[model samples]
Target: MEADMSAGDLDRRVQFRRVTRMNTALGQEETWADLGSPVWASRRDVSDGEKAAAGGVFSTVSARFQIRSSTFSRGITAKDMLTCDGREWEIVGIKEIGRRDRIEITATARTDR
Candidate 1:
């Protein structure tokens, strides 16, 4: 789906974050660090699905975020995660729209931390 990226639709503030792993004496410690200042984005819930694993069903929610293209947004990758409204979304894909006018981020809701 194409996002119009209108000003009103970009109503939510989202922050991009990356995970940093450090090797410690005992083990590896991973931490999430902010990439840049929060930016306005248009967030939409795309779909929800259930995954069956280990004799259980797990629910996952997918979402799409549209943000204006910039230096920071252009550098984003699938390894990055987005935080919005106190929820973390794992980035699944990144696509540039219309000569880099905007970027569409596809992500899945992460409840396992």
Candidate 2:
């Protein structure tokens, strides 16, 4: 089960992307955007629930995936996000089930770059 990371701290975590119907003129799909973060986020933040709360540019579509969090601290971190080999994410915000509840992985999309 995903853990809640609200009271702890929202730091860099994993990134995810989903396919959108929209693509570049060349038909090439742009899944990520440059929002001062190097991690290439997918279409959906998997756990990204609300929009207004996590203010940022986002794609119309999203997807679901699995990831692991820190065991010592026993939680997820942006540094745990992997793209191909191993990548880090700039956690925009964390969606907590409740106070001190297990935090699930959610993210917001930036502009395609």
Candidate 3:
């Protein structure tokens, strides 16, 4: 038996995109193309990690998104990106729950280089 998803759990709308790479004569090009329509997902802050070594200090903001399994397919991977609340997040990890009933995506905010 599988658990049902609560409507209240999915409150935020997020857009998913797959990263596409193309090889050209000059070099490689990458683009983000929409995978499908926007879907409702539950968002939460997972963790905050910091590292201070011999080099400069580094910090990471991690977040999790729970969505219907049907919303995303196997094509979605760590190279993908999610857009929510006018911000873009890079997908770092993905986990399938309860026989693909739902999916949990771990991501970090996309920072400008």
Q: Per-candidate TM vs. native?
A: 0.86, 0.25, 0.74
Model 2 C-alpha lDDT per residue in residues 21-42, reported as the tens digit of each score: 4567889674543222233222
lDDT of 1 by residue, 1-113 (tens): 65467899899999989999989998999999999899999988989888888998778889999999998899999999999989888899999888889999999985544
Candidate 3: list runs displaced more than 4 Å: 1-3, 21-28, 49-60, 110-113
The better-scoring model by lDDT among 2 and 3 is 3
Clashing pairs in 1: none
lDDT of each: 0.89, 0.36, 0.82
Best by lDDT: 1
Model 2, position 70, has a per-residue lDDT of 29
Give the C-alpha miss distance for residue 43 in model 1, angstroms. 1.2
Q: Can you write out model 3's per-residue Cα lDDT over 29-95, one digit (the tens) per residue? A: 9888888888999999978777675886666667999898873455578878999888788898999
- Reference-based TM-score, model 3: 0.74
**How does candidate 1 score on lDDT?**
0.89
Better of 2 and 3 by TM-score: 3
* Candidate 3, number of clashes: 0
